[model samples]
Target: MVDIKSWIFKDCCLVFSLLCISIVGITTGDQEVLTNSWLVELSEGGEAAARDIAKRAGFSYVSPVLGSDTEFHFIHNAVPKTRFRRSILHTRKLKSHPFVKRAVQQTGFVRSKRGYKPLKGVLLSDLHINNPEIGQLINDEKDVVIGKDPTDPLFDKEWFLKNRGQSGGIKGLDLNVEAAWGMGFTGKGVTTAIMDDGIDYLHEDLKYNYNSEASYDFSSNDHFPYPRYTDTWFNSHGTRCAGEIAAARDNDVCGVGVAYDSKVAGLRMLDQPFMTDLIEANAMGHMPNIIDIYSASWGPTDDGKTVDGPRNLTMRAIVKGVNEGRNGKGNIYVWASGDGGQEDDCNCDGYAASMWTISINSATNDGQTAGYDESCSSTLASTFSNGKSTIRDAGVATTDLYNNCTTTHSGTSAAAPEAAGIFALALEANRNLTWRDMQHLTVLTSKRNRLFDPYLKHFWQYNGAGLEFNHLFGYGVLDAGAMVYMANHWKPLPERFHCTAGSIKKEMNFGTNEPITLTIDTDACKGTDNEVNFLEHLQAFVTVKSSYRGNIVMHLTSPMNTTSMILSQRPNDDEHKNGFTRWPFMTTHTWAEAPRGTWTLRVENIAGKNNEYDDGLFREWTLVLHGTRDPPYHHQDADEENQTKLFKVKRMHDMAMKN
Candidate 1:
């Protein structure tokens, strides 16, 4: 019942008492976490097969190595790797006598004639037992000196900033903000544009910092985007979000924001009830140069079924905002990753799953995954938000509509503005960062899988660039100080590149008992200007006719075998709807992965309900790969955010697309 992580820290240092506890716990007893360390690579096996291997090998399975089907990575829970009782300290080497080659190569690798393969093995000696976010092996040259705590009277209650287990919160598990604040980065000059319902610009906490010129009410033709709520009380959502990003500091009414000194401009649109592609597009590009970051708390319905994205004009506007905003520095967009609970997938929401927007999810005050959390490969980072437990008080405190302050702002809605606020601070630290630059900063500085969540599918996954990722937590929690520290010295990235595959009109039989996989090649990706080496985001557009949309579970697998749960079966989504009508499903799983060979997308009618309209038509399917050119294809520019260099765009490999 004790948080072992807390024991690791004493007197403001990782004292020996905790280390001895962990070390003693490992060397003496059957501690599931400490004893479950193993560096396993399967000759052949998928996740299920790997689980079976772990069961047979007397180990508890955590996750495959970065979602690799060919490799098996499990933990030893007992001493010396016995059945159910695995030990790490008691053994130096593990015997995988029965855990040999389970790999099923699609293109096929070389086979051995002697019925024996040279088994390859390696060990990661420094990995924390189940905690990948403890810290990375970064060569940081700057001193991380935390600033003095804010003088706000209620600052101690703001556990998300400095947590010491207040009200069920975890100590030192909040958005690592103390150090950033210490560096004097309070989002001094940056501006965030809130594309939500409205904001309470008159609120004492957010009045002086409101950017009037950039603020607009799209729902009403008003100059000030004020939260006008006479009926719906929660219409103060925008104001709450703004408060999270730029609430006043010392003279605080509620609590201070992540970027307390930053300016916020509200662009109200959701209150209109009916918004078109043009309306959303205008909201997206409201003030490209003036609005430094676009923070949106609303997206398609989070009912675990609705699949909606931006229309044509909106897409173009977003693309333009990133390409031409900030005097060609690329305008940044921060979007809440949707609070659909575990039943929903963010891939179904276009705005959250978009390649341009930095999708943000929520963690909780207790350092656990919020119950209303959705999972996706596109999730970049997570920030602390309220937990779903009514008995607990994990909600955030911010400005309310009637010039009052509320402390109940929760969900991914509140998380996005927190990210925007942090990003504003980062932007203030480094003004020349392009949109891609900010993404790079997030990937590098954001905390990776911190074992505290307990919901991680895998502890650590290495992308093509060797970056770690987890399914439930994405790249990990937001590290405000680390991001600002990196932002101060961050460089520019290479120019954007785009590559596409063929659009095949296909169909699916609702009465099928087996799963269907549509495969495509990438030879076309070897164009002069469109060739891609590794990937940033991969998008698939599909149209289907289905009676029960919830019966579908679609997965997209890259050539590297990294599978993305694009659309999972949402039980509540039982309504008969047009399934995947040109819906663009995006994934960040292929980050830094080479776009070559055959990519497979599997679609299955999970329920297999033999009913009317059981048969579904694929209609058409298309893929677009966006990434930078890898080595051997063209001259690689290490500067990831430098837009002046449009990049070499040379073909990394011959993209024999659709071969």
Candidate 2:
């Protein structure tokens, strides 16, 4: 045996050295000092020359940035702390060096977990009691269990896994993982890394499946990623997430994990004073070959006012993971769409909006959108989370910190791990599945089932491909049984391609009531090597100037006439100074649609009664389509035919519902 864990650790240490750097440019108690760390980018084939230059400049070369070959970190311990001017001069010298391509002093940014409030509306003080509908549903079929039930005491309360109307939930409204488990696909050989605060590897339910070799603490520069102790147990977030993925089955401790036989690794990068570019890069790119999935429930603040995403180094890391990780099959990155509720829009969040990640939202046990679920076109799917009513208080059940178990793992944080676990099972069913393949399986196998937005804030509609999607639920809640069944016979998609179909350079002005409409007609790069006939992901890179940015609402209509709400009004976003600049508003709503006709973009100012500003201008925009030249379902086998049948059935059901 190769001892995969040890191999992964050695590989990580070979090219990644720990840097004892301090926060740069941050003020501590009215004193501001520049740190010694510098992000240095070297010219191609100039490593030796760059090292020589660093030595001459009295700077020690650290390791290469986790995913890049030419970019590196350098430090000067002799003058560890310096004034801003001195640091700037040093940066200028490095950039001016012949071998250096770029150099900048490292700065820190804030990254918050998706669900900061674990018990947003389900606190004990707010709990409802003695309600008729709050009691658990009795299982009538005692002898015909679908899968071997785990003896874990809390398993029954884990309604997301196997809901039998538990806690006033609708029966059968769950992930449907039991049938897949009965088929023996328990994510046996897969490993999922929780990129969060930290994980309690010593927890009884998690210790058996913990892969310590692949675990690391970027916050404290250690191998053990044990979360820091706190009285409020706030740091238990990662552990709770891990338990959702790989907690041992029938352990008499907590509820069984979604992929009970799978392994879990902890990447403790979030329990730090500030998040650095290097730290984010290292965590995402760590042990890519060994870790199959990276489940992140954190992102830029969910406050509807902020619009941010991955910085440069982190962006490079994600691209590298998708292009070169897992022997070129690509690493699966699962993200939690923001929890900003109706006031926020997830398109403003760059991480969830990125095409590379599968953004998951949250649903209640009764198949309704959670109160905190942020609506976005980029959300790929949804999973179960906390749902409180006068009837019952239902939340996720999983392991907690210090050998404890929690029945209230709420938020998108709790929802993402379930998706990760389901993906792990699919990976085990077919190890050759790529990141894109996983996404295809999600779109194909996920079922609308009984999920809906109870408030009707978002409605389910079939796109051009007859695949149903919702801004809140995406394709729908994940169906683990369907996913694994399809994965067993899935074929790898053809090589992916991208084409810039068209661009608009001139600015067009529009008033609050008038809508700005633009069109692009192309063959989707036909007759070229980068031809993209079938659309998988579309990006409308846009630049706009608005007096009040919050009033801006944008929509993209594909050549197939499937309209996508790419951008929506954010009540909290009043930023007018720097309107959107080349922000890629992406959507998977046009999946498998032909991209060879006129595509339309409609920009509206939903200012309505509160028009705080006068007018807006559409500066410039570009339409980029990504897909394969050939039909991705070239091998139209029985699985594909069967899935199409399911779609037809769903379409009929949708029509009846509308009627």
Alpha carbon lDDT of each predicted model: 0.65, 0.79
lDDT of 2 by residue, 583-639 (tens): 778898988777788999999788733655548888888888888777676463324
RMSD values for the candidates in order, in angstroms, are 25.5, 7.9
Put down candidate 1 lDDT per residue, 1-659, tens digits, no spaces. 11123222222232221111110001111333222344455555457766776676666665443224655445454442223333432232334445454321111011001101122111112111221112222223345442345554445556777776776776677786766776668899899998877888887778899999998875565687776665546466787778888888777366688899899998987764334443576688777889999988777667675655665446656767877788788889998888887777877677788878999888887767787778776788888777444644456766667666655677788788889988998898889988887886776567753424566543556554445666667777888877887678664555566666656676546443356778987763675666776677787766664566666777888776777777776666664545666666777766666777777888776663344335455666677777766432233232232222213122222332222
* Clashes per candidate, residues 3 or more apart or on different chains: 32, 0
TM-score to native of every candidate shown: 0.71, 0.85
**lDDT winner:** 2
Worst 10 residues of 2 by lDDT: 18-27
Q: Model 2 residue 608 lDDT?
A: 39
Clashing pairs in 2: none
lDDT of candidate model 2 versus the reference: 0.79
In candidate 1, position 351 carries an lDDT of 75
